[model samples]
Target: MRLFRPSRRAASLSVVLAATLLATAACSGDDAAGGSGDDVVEVNFGYIPDFNGTSLLAVAQDQGLWEKHGVEVEATSFTNGPLQIQALGTGDLDFGYIGPGAFWLPASGQAKIVAMNTLGQADRVVAQPGIDSIEDLEGKKVAIPEGTSGDMILTLALQDAGMTKDDVEIVPMEPAAIVAALSSGKVDGAGFWYPALATVKKQVPDLVELAENGDFEDTVAFPTAFVAGNDVVADDEEKVDRVLAALRDAIAYRADHMDETIELTAEFNDLPVADVRADAENVQVLDLEEIDGYTQDGTFDTWLSGMQDYFVQSGQLPEAVEPSEFYTGDLFLGAGE
Candidate 1:
């Protein structure tokens, strides 16, 4: 049995890596299997086994961008951010793609942020038809992956709607289970993200979106990001930058080649092309120039810092870590200058 099963995204790489990579104790930088070529840097990059988390990775894997940048990416999938953070701390994973846990891992000093992957646009309060608003969800069952951005959004939505967690039965389930539950009427609704978010709605077309990433924008921004282990940031600048350069290229490719991005993601992850395309449309990733602006104008910092404070108030984090401690913004395409 695969110890870690697929949660939000497709499992093409996860299935292979679970049996192969997870079998290995660790694949840290110093101990990773050597590339056939000497100049190639080997990186153990971890991501959630889903479309939003794995899109750029899918692009890099399919488009030959990693090899073009002289890096050999060992793509690994985790069920969630903390698992990746555990691997990073133990020198197993060098970097990760993470969502809500992005805030906790960094704030708890378990990981460090390197770059933004998606700007928290994929999650929403999805419900069965006739349930048209957040208040309608009161006294009902709603499924959400615990500690995810979706969870945060729902918490705030409840407050805004004049309800509380107690007002609804919050059913904590895996992404796959959430899909099944919502479709079967086991859950009246879900605070969820793609591609599972897209999957459930497509499976049951009458599902209604009660609130979404944009609705929570006035409260917080749930960004998914590529995060690195502490040691890598402290010493391995070249390796860090090389990986970033390759990812940056993948981002550039994803912006204009969205069709290719959707197709490649579906192909690599064994997901339905239509649903994958829909999920792709549902989320948003920043381009290089936008990333630069976020970094320079302090919007990016504000986005995360405010969100972190809410995380503290929401009792997810005991306290906040200085942005400098959690975010190494100077590493990517010349940010933090």
Candidate 2:
């Protein structure tokens, strides 16, 4: 577990470091990862194992929705959003179901957000039996997936609790490892998302959930989106739209077949079906108006702006980012149409 301190961090550094190296890495005249192949699009979509971000896409793939849309989807699992953003920048990944952190890539001219996905209570801070509340996290060793939704939510939760980085010993680790470290008593608490959190609770039935996205003011859930590299968006616009449409279709299918969808998500991630089902409840698939509202009414802007501010204030980002520059409602609108 790696700990992130304010003195040694840059929120947008992942995108910044890889931007120049990967911006044209895909421009070698090679077809994009999701480029047309024999009249079918080849999509290399990256995602984490959590239910919120990967569930619908997995539903799409499992139900053959991608093929129905004349696309072949290759789903790649990543441990965290930052790694997915890295692959996206390198052209190895065409699209990613990523969190607000990856949104920074687009703000820095590294990628594009095709459509908003879920806005739900997917993230939480789980503490050992000894810790009961956010205030209990103070002076404790806390683990979080650095540069991810877990990290962001933890930051906000700390602020809400009237705490700061100095209060807790931050341990940055992969989601799985966070659970491992916590279960083994290496850390007192961890900030992360489900269904991993579900696994932790099973292992430690006495674990306490300190906070989640809903616990914060003016927030319902953490935001996630279908993000694509600029090159993929530039060269194969139709593929992007088709992918978004497939996701929309997947969302509907999940609604119609809730049990089957949950089971599939559980199997895909090797998590308990009950865990998947429970976490699913916290995830809200965005509707047309909600998707459009993200950009039209400053919904997405507000979330991204707050994330940027937190990053800058925490030294994760050097300066503020203009949310409008990296996000768009075009694919979202087209999919709805």
Candidate 3:
């Protein structure tokens, strides 16, 4: 069985390099608690297996790039973005990779999005072959992580097909459980990201891809980004900078060395290399420039507004909270500049 390992060397290096970067940027001061050469800053980051951004994190750790930059990054796996955001708010985590929906909690004054990490077309809602059409999902069981980007997309697809959530039995489950649920005939459809989607399709050759972001016009923003607590960012600006810089390099490496990145990601996730390669076709690796545009847009703001509206209509949140409160593009833009 493939197990996950967090890189101690990378994490330690990230902290140290972060301090140096901040000092070089002329942003360091006594109030900033400037660390001596011996202080080891620890940054805990959360990631999900299926997200393409995780590959970058895995590479950064395995390669010790973060260490070269003087920062320490500990990457942990979370079941989903919501849980990851929850951890960020409670200070159990320093940073994490999450979908656009993560802005909701942060907008509610819980956390903040430090940087828009990666943007790409990766998520897909797949159904059994015979059920090619979304309408066919009626009376069928569909599995998705509740309140996730996938779930929202699934809902939109259903609505577009003149159907509603009531038309199908929605089951809440993690990506790992999705394949089994479909293979066992317990679920007629599932909304998931690449590697997991590839695994499910491999087992169920007749799987149908119902919908993806690329299929929808005027909806190009899928802000899957790295977020940190406000306290974390304020307490260690240098560390945050180093983390972003390392990730920026990792992203570059991913774009330049697709095969190697895919192989490592496949190994990290314990999936076949061919499966990872196939999934790579849909993965969008964002550079610093692209990430800047994504965060500036009202894309995340608009999405949060839509989600808040949905929550209010569904009785999820008390009412629509302010979107600006949840997200701040300062750190993301600052890092790129």
Once fitted onto the true fold, the runs of candidate 3 whose alpha carbons sit more than 4 angstroms away are 1-37, 101-103, 293-324
Residue-by-residue lDDT tens digits, candidate 2, 80-187: 777877788899999987786455556667788777777757778788997888898888899988888788778788888888878999988877788788778889
**Cα lDDT of model 1 by residue, 1-337, tens digit:** 7696567455776677787865455433323322225677789998886667888999988887776666887888677776777899999999987886347778788888888777757778888889999999989999988877778778878878888889999898877788899878888998887677666766789889888778767767777888999899888887888788777888888888888888888877788888887776767768878876787787878877887788787787888766766877767756211
By TM-score rank, best first, the candidates go 1, 2, 3
Which has the higher TM-score value, candidate number 1 or candidate number 2?
A: 1
Note the residue pairs that clash in candidate 2.
2-172, 10-316, 11-316, 34-42, 120-221
Shift of residue 213 alpha carbon in model 3, Å? 2.2
User: Least accurate stretch of 10 residues (summed lDDT) in model 3?
Assistant: 27-36
RMSD of each: 14.8, 18.5, 11.8
TM-score preference between candidates 1 and 3, better one: 1
Write the number of the candidate with greater TM-score, choosing between 2 and 3: 2
Model 1 misplaced regions, further than 4 Å: 1-36, 335-337
